[model samples]
Target: AQSVTQLDSHVSVSEGTPVLLRCNYSSSYSPSLFWYVQHPNKGLQLLLKYTSAATLVKGINGFEAEFKKSETSFHLTKPSAHMSDAAEYFCVVSDPGGGYNKLIFGAGTRLAVHP
Candidate 1:
């Protein structure tokens, strides 16, 4: 089984400022970790993923995250925040043992971008 914990329920930032979203997970087996973004009623979009191939993974826009095995952490970061970056973020955990289609998502982090 795999699970995720989103440290914050909300993150606020101003335009052109740095943004950070923290996440952690646990699993019986090595799991595939992912970060997805949802804007309003739109469908979820894949931000980035860690598949044991690389430690640091870069996603769309300026978003990036690092998978730390020892800490079981995958925290997302962006050097500068944009107004359009405001959205709900989810940290997902998936295990091949569960067919890879099953994903356990975190509660979510709402990002509010100020002008």
Candidate 2:
């Protein structure tokens, strides 16, 4: 069984500061990882993903994550945070089996931006 844990339920950032969200996972085999963001009442959008190609993956909105197999961690980071960056972020892990993907979603991290 694989699972993901979000270290913090909420994160607050200043308008122009950097943003960091922590995530940890436990999996029997190497799994695919992803980060998705959702605004107030909008749908979820893919921030980035790692599918066994590159250890470092970049996504939209200047966000990126590095796959650290040894640490079993995939943390999301942004060089600078913007007002629009304020949203709920989810860390997800998927296992590819028999030509199918089983996804496990994280609880979610709520990001608050202060002006």
Candidate 2 local lDDT, 3-115, one digit each (tens): 88989999999999999999998887778999999999999999999988999999999999989999999999998899999999999999665658888899999999899
Candidate 2's C-alpha runs over 4 A off are 97-99
Error of 2 at 18 (Å): 0.6
Question: Over the stretch 1-115, how does candidate 1's per-residue lDDT look in tens digits?
Answer: 6899999999999999999999999988877899999999999999998888889999999899999989989999999999999999999998666455688899999999999
Against the true structure, whose lDDT is highest?
Answer: 1
TM-score of each: 0.94, 0.94
* Candidate 1 collision pairs: none
What is each predicted model's overall lDDT from 0 to 1? 0.93, 0.92
- Clashing residue pairs in candidate 2 (N, C-alpha, C atoms within 3 angstroms): none
- In model 1, the Cα lDDT at residue 94 comes to 86
